[model samples]
Every structure is written in structure tokens, then in C-alpha cells.
Target: MHIESDQEGYRSCVNNSTSCQAYITYQALQDDTLQPVGLCFRLSVEQLAEALQIAQYLSVALDLFTSMDCELSSVTYIVGLKACRGLASEKESDKGLYLEKGITIHKGVKEHGFKTDIVVATNFLEMYSNCSSMHHAREVFESMFSQDAVAWNTLILGYVENGDYAVAMDLFSIMDCEPNCVTYLAALKACGGLASEPESEKQHHLQKGIGIHKKLQEGGFGSDIVVAITLVDMYGECGSMQNARDVFDRMIQCNAVTWTSLILGYVGNGQCSEAMDLFARMDCE
Candidate 1:
């Protein structure tokens, strides 16, 4: 069997292990063992982590550039944040240091005055939120004179994650305008966390949820597989299998999520026979 030129070139590079003058190509292979440009680009970007490691080995600070601009790209800043967070946790002696680094970078950005840049601001909020520094997240949020839905959603999510659902709901309610799909999803999850509810209270939240669902459908988010799956999961957890099933049945294309949610809904609601029937149908599909 004869090898193709690209394969031959790859093999030659691997054998020689020398600096290459030719424009070398690399790719990511999927499970079926085919390669595509889309996959290759994804793989290349993923390799940045490994490249960072190699740069470390060479005693190079990848973030340090001698150029006057000296600006790091957003991706590089995020990667730096990840690296700092990863180390700041494992090295117990470095306690308070990761958050310090995050604060420092954020301060530098502010002193340099990219404070108004939404991308940088969002990254700062994410770093603080992930570091379990809700105070810092709040400061960052409050510093912004104006916020789009993304900023509001992030803070609401942070509050929910930090186990302050009341604050999350309060912030959610007082927002100047209606919540977007992501906001609705987060709010629904928080509402579903209610352990025990009086029948009247349950009806209130359920009605609110139904209203959100209607808004979602009107906003063209109803057909989103992720939103649909989340609705199914939420309704199932809340003992609303009928609602879950309605969502599932409405899906134009059912994937693993739709099938799993249906099975889960029946199992959760103690409808074992229905769960088993769905499983059988899924297997046939």
C-alpha cells in the first residue's frame, strides 16, 4: 500500500525531529478516524495548554512580551487565570494568593483603563466567582455602570452557586427588564431547589415557570435542545412528568438528552412501567 503525501510528510517530520521549513500540517482524528479542518482547528487551540507547558519548560513567560503594546489576548488572559487558579489551590501555602493574582490582574486592567471592556470585565467576574470570592464578584459587578443581560446572568449564577438563592431571586426580580433564556434557566433551577412547598406556594412558582416557558417559546428558545432538556430535567425533578413528557414529545429531533430525561421523569415519578417502555423505545431507535 502507498502512503499519501501528507502522511509521508508527517512521518518524515516525526522521524527527523528537526526544525521544519515546510508548512507542516496536523489534525485531530475523530472516533471514526477521519480528520476535518474544523476538528483540526479545535485540536490546535486545545494544544495551547500543552504549548504553555512547553514554554514553561523553556523558562519562558509566555505572557511577557517585549513589544510596546505588551497586550495579552483574551484567550491568553483566561489561560493565565486558569493556571493561577490550578496552582493556587494545590499549593496550600499559597492560600489567598490566587485571588490576589486575580485582583492584581483586574487592578492592572483598571489602572490601564480597559475597565469598561465587557470581555475583560466578564473575565474578572468569572475569576472572582470561581475563586469563591463572592465579595470580589459583587465589587466587579457593581463597578460596571451599565450591564447587559450577560453580566446580570453571571452575577445571578454566582449567587445561586454560592448558596444564596434568595439573593439570586431578589436580584433576578429587580432587574429592569425581563430575563433572557439563560436567566430563566438559572432561576428555574434555583426555584426547583425548594425542598417542601405549600400547595399554594407551589402553584405560584409553577405558574411563574409556565410564564417563563411561554416567553422562551416566544423568543424562539423553546426549540433549543439544551433549553428543552433543561426544562424536562427541571419538571421531572419537580414531580411534573406530564410537563416533561409534553416538552419531549414536542421536540422535532430527540437525542440522548430527550430520551434520558423521559426515562428519568418516569423513574422519578414512580412510573416504573413508563420508564421501562421509554427505555425499550430508545433501544429500538
Candidate 2:
């Protein structure tokens, strides 16, 4: 009887884990006392999975579920993919197996005629991105029949996170959807990444950064405090103190981040005196 009850509990746990996780998350948000409850649950999952090699069981269950269900929902795939991603990161030897499982699910999604589902595609793209599989992410993105701003932003940020700044810039240029604030911020980060390249590539990236800066202004993001601060930092990192200062001077508001970016830019360029002056002004403010 105990064994049968335990088996029932395992089945229930597998079926209801997602809801349990959601409830735990809500509890944590609503009450500070519940924060440790969520953390403990997450930590226990990892520890239990490690002890019992649960990834193997999960893979088998996923295969069975997919085979039995004529049409798998996007949410199901997303949850499965997330689990694969977590397992992939846990051990080098397990990475290939989990990645292959994710790829299988991707193929299944297409074969089962859910390819046009944007949420599913985005979740698939994000799963690949999180797993450091940019090539797969790009493939999923490019295959989308219609892309949204969020989808475009996801791929753009994915490239930036993967250190493929050049591709991120190219993707940004061809994006059919209107770029959002997150898009602009990710592009700025790509420019910053470019500035860190070798001397031979430095000027080329600086020019690209300047073009993005112009776009930011035209898009009316010039006054956004975060955007303005990013511009200062980008120009400073590229050794363009004059342009950085030009942006700083135009800002209607200057926060601590804005002041710090300029000061660091001056310091980076070996202009300690100018940095000191800016620090004094920042202190006064």
C-alpha cells in the first residue's frame, strides 16, 4: 500500500509540478516569509534530480506524452524545453543528450503543424539562446512566418549575449518590426561589445555605434536617462570623449549613472583632471 501511494505521489508530482512552482512563486511575491519556501523547492528539485538521475525519466515521460498526445500545446513544449535547458547546464556529458531532446521537440513542433505559433517559436528561440545555441536560435527565428517586436528583440539580445555583436547589428538593421526600448538597449550593448574589438576593427564599430546613436535620437529616445547614459558610456569606451560630452551636455536630466559614465570615460582616456572636475560637479549636484 505504501509503495502504491508513493507511485501515485510521483505521478501527481510530475503532473502538477508546474502549478506547484507557480503557487510557490506567487507565495514568495505576496509574503516575504514565503521566499525561503520557493528557494527550498527549487534547490530540492536540483538535488533530487541529481540523486535519482531524473533527467532520464523526464526524457522518457516526454517521449511518451508526445506520442500519446496528437497535438502538444505550446506551454507543454516550453516547460519541457526549460527542463532540458536546466539539465543541459548541469553536466557536460548530459549536455548533448538534453540538447538533442530539445531539438527533437523543435522538429516535432514543426512536423505537427505548430510552426506558426509565435509564443512557441519565441520560447523555442529563448531555450536555444539560453543553452548557448545561437545557430539553432537563429534558425528558429528565421523560420518564423511572422515576427513580432518581442521575437526580434529576443534574437537580437540573444546574439548580443552570445558575443555575436556583428550579427546582432545586422539583425537589428533588417528588423521589419518597430524597435522597442529593449531593442535599442540591446543594440547599444552590441556597440559596446564592438568597441572592445581589436584596433583594426575599432573604427568600424565606432562608426556603427555612431549610426545607432543617431537612430536613438531620431526615435526620441534621446531624453531617456538610461539611453543617454548608455550613449555616454559607448562613446567613452570607443575613445570618443568629445561625442560623449556632446551627448551629456544635451541631456535635460543627469542622474548619478550619467555622471559616472562621463567621469569613467574621461578617466579611461587618461584625462584625470577632467574626470575630477566632473566628479566635483556630480558631488555638488
- Clashes (backbone N, CA, C under 3 Å), per candidate, total 0, 0
lDDT of 1: 0.64
Best by TM-score: 1
lDDT of 2 by residue, 143-204 (tens): 98899999999999989888998899999999998888789888888988888777677677
Model 1: ten consecutive residues of lowest lDDT: 58-67
TM match of model 2 to true structure: 0.65
lDDT of 1 by residue, 1-285 (tens): 112325444344323332221112121222235332333223333343334433341111122211113344445455555555455444557637677877767766766667787767776776676676889888888888788889888888877766676677788888876679889887766655541244446556666567768878989899999888878876776677888899999998999878998898789779999999999999999
Model 2 accuracy (lDDT, Cα):
0.72
Which residue window of length 10 is worst by lDDT in model 2? 44-53
